[model samples]
Target: MNKRMTGVMAAGAAVITLCASSALAAAGRESSADMRGVSVLVGGGVEGYTRGLGADIQPGAAYGATVILRPTKVVGLELGYAGASNNFDRSNVAVSEATRGPDVMRNGGQAVATLGLTASPVQPYLLAGLGISRYNVRATAAGFQDDTVGNVPLGGGLRVHLGHFTADARINYNVLVDQQLATDLPSTSATSSTGGIYTGTVNLGSTF
Candidate 1:
């Protein structure tokens, strides 16, 4: 695995560790409020790489896990890890080209503030989060380093609770954050990648 993939895995592992630690900490609490409990969910789904990396990447396999801490009936804290693998190939041979581009992956982590709409078995919630993404790119292309960019995820989802099990469907629109001009593939001067990542996935989980 390359550094990009390593970084992605590291970030994801870190999030999982944090979640475990938080759950342990919460386990010692004496709160009787179910709304103030800790919950962990594991699931996998497909993601659409609608506009990632200059806009054109196609949909790919996406899967992730998340941990939630609800402090109140209407508010919660969530940390998640999402990863998608795609066949990444782009070229601008007229000026420059990414000759070794293919099968590049995208990995990301998110920290969001979740607001629940109701306390019923069927609930809807909105989530807004800040996330960082690492792209696994081909290194043969000079001056083309794998990008680690920040992004904002804005979306909401619906959740159905039955007993201790839950099912969820969410769609998030990723707005790739802007950055200063960094590099030029053909060593002309500099350029920036302005695009976005969008995803829609379903998850199945249970509360403990």
Candidate 2:
């Protein structure tokens, strides 16, 4: 499933890029082929696990770097890596099984499509992407053995550009798509919940 999703995402990204470039060419915006730029972003944010897991996971800080390729002023492709550590929320869930709930090491890479609302310096954009997240959960009691799955991230935000400086803020929800993650969990168990993540971040970057 991960392999198939990756291929579909790559194909989809290509189609979107082609259509965007063609539209820009028809609009006479500096020939999409000739107009190209790159940006490097540094960002930090908070995220949390949501779903039916053995234990409640607390929201935690996350940070990552992203490189953007802008083929046109209004269209860009982004590739990034981010990771966060979440501890089980012991206050709400039962922790008697061991000492703590499952400890998870979440990390992944994402390919995204960004569409700017305008070509101006201060532009608002919408973005959505596909990612494969490795959810390393240590829960011997709940029967969750597998560790990785696909994600659907939906988000939008504003980008402020000033000379070589760029800044942006965004919020997103990452939905996990695989049901087999709970292959070991009993069907009646609450730990068999489908998990997701929510994040909000601000970034500072430089464009060249």
Among the numbered candidates, top lDDT falls to: 2
Off by over 4 Å in 1: 1-36, 50-55, 89-102, 138-144, 179-193
lDDT of 1 at 26: 52
The weakest ten consecutive residues by lDDT in model 2 span 184-193
Superposed by TM-score, candidate 1 places the C-alpha of residue 79 at a distance from the truth, in angstroms, of 0.9
Models 1 onward score TM values of 0.66, 0.69
Residue 73 displacement (Å), model 1 = 2.9
Q: Which residue pairs show collisions in model 1?
A: 92-96
Supply every candidate's count of residue pairs whose N, Cα or C atoms clash at under 3 angstroms: 1, 0
Q: Taking the tens digit of each residue's C-alpha lDDT, what string does model 2 give over 1-208? A: 1243334335434543454444444543333223248999888766666655423567766678899999888898999987766666666544435535335567888998999897765567899998887777654424444467777778887666555666667767776666345554333322224566776666777888
- What is the lDDT of every predicted structure here? 0.60, 0.65
**Candidate 1 TM-score to native:** 0.66
Cα RMSD for predicted model 1: 10.4
Please write out the lDDT profile of model 1 over residues 73-141, one tens digit for every residue: 677788999887654334531214444334556788999988888765456789998888887754343
**Lowest lDDT block of 10, candidate 1:** 180-189
